[model samples]
Target: MKKYLVQFKPFLIFIGTFFATYILLTLIYKSYLNHFESDDVDEITRIVGYNVDLLLHAFNSDVFIQKSVSNPWLEVWYNNDYVIRIVEGCNAVSVIILFISFVIAFSRKFKTTFLFILSGTLFIYILNIVRIALLAILLFRYPEKVHLFHGVLFPLMIYGVVFALWVFWVNKFSKYAK
Candidate 1:
């Protein structure tokens, strides 16, 4: 038993750290969300929606986002069409938390880990905004393919970037790389 425990110590530590960080960050985010009234969209989601609106407008696309009166989401209108809802899950905080947790679990030096987390979080946030904007445009053009665009392709794109980031971290930056 002791021999097996010693052999698996590193793996156990990685899993423990990953889950602990994930849970802590998720709880903090949830608490922040709880501060908002049920009918009101949380600040992060609103910010994402605002950014999406800005990005679309920058491209000379007709777009606007407004808080939904009846629900906790923002309605994204693109090209004078109702395209999608920007919800809390669309804010990408959850993805950032997951990225941070994995990075921490494989972390070595404090500065490197902190920098990676900061940069990675920013990258994910920006990518998500772009994703939302692109998704809005695509959905407006291909309303019949909502499932393919929203449910599959967009998710694949976000998660694919995350997976690529993880691979880069493990190969180039993580303690395991050494």
Candidate 2:
């Protein structure tokens, strides 16, 4: 009924905007993955990740970057010492998704959502820095385990954290959920 619709307009708007953004973005993301080579962004991520990796290794660990190749062609990096370093694309996506999901889960109003998104974004950036650092150490210490370390484990870990945060937000923080 019109009355019910009017009462839920704000809620509807939030849901609509959130879902619309997500769905549209997902489609675009898929299209890009299918049609375009995103090696540029991937290379940028690798550069960032590698820098973080070196910094973490400097904290009294045996990790060393003997040589790194910035392959602009396929976004691949090879440590002359250790072959086939993990790509940074997936890590970057995970970081971005984590913050977006956090904002959706935690925020109620526009202002709060913006602030919370910013805060969550900051956390995402920091977590990425940490992720890169950890990845570097693991890459050095367990070079053969790169697939499990980069492809499976860290992403699962980050997503698990985001899922927990989402559960907390909906149960403990979201006013609309109540």
Off by over 4 Å in 1: none
**Model 1 lDDT at residue 39:** 92
lDDT of 1 at 3: 98
TM-score for each model: 0.98, 0.62
Residue pairs in steric clash, candidate 1? none
lDDT per model vs. reference: 0.92, 0.59
Cα shift from native, residue 4, model 1 (Å): 1.0
Quick one: best TM-score, which candidate?
Answer: 1
Cα lDDT of model 1 overall? 0.92
Instruction: For each candidate in turn, give its C-alpha RMSD to the true structure in angstroms.
Output: 0.7, 5.2
Clashing pairs in 2: none
What would the per-residue lDDT of candidate 1 be over residues 57-170, giving only the tens digit for each residue?
Answer: 888998878988899999998878889999989999999999999999999989999998999999999999999998898889889999998999999999999999999999
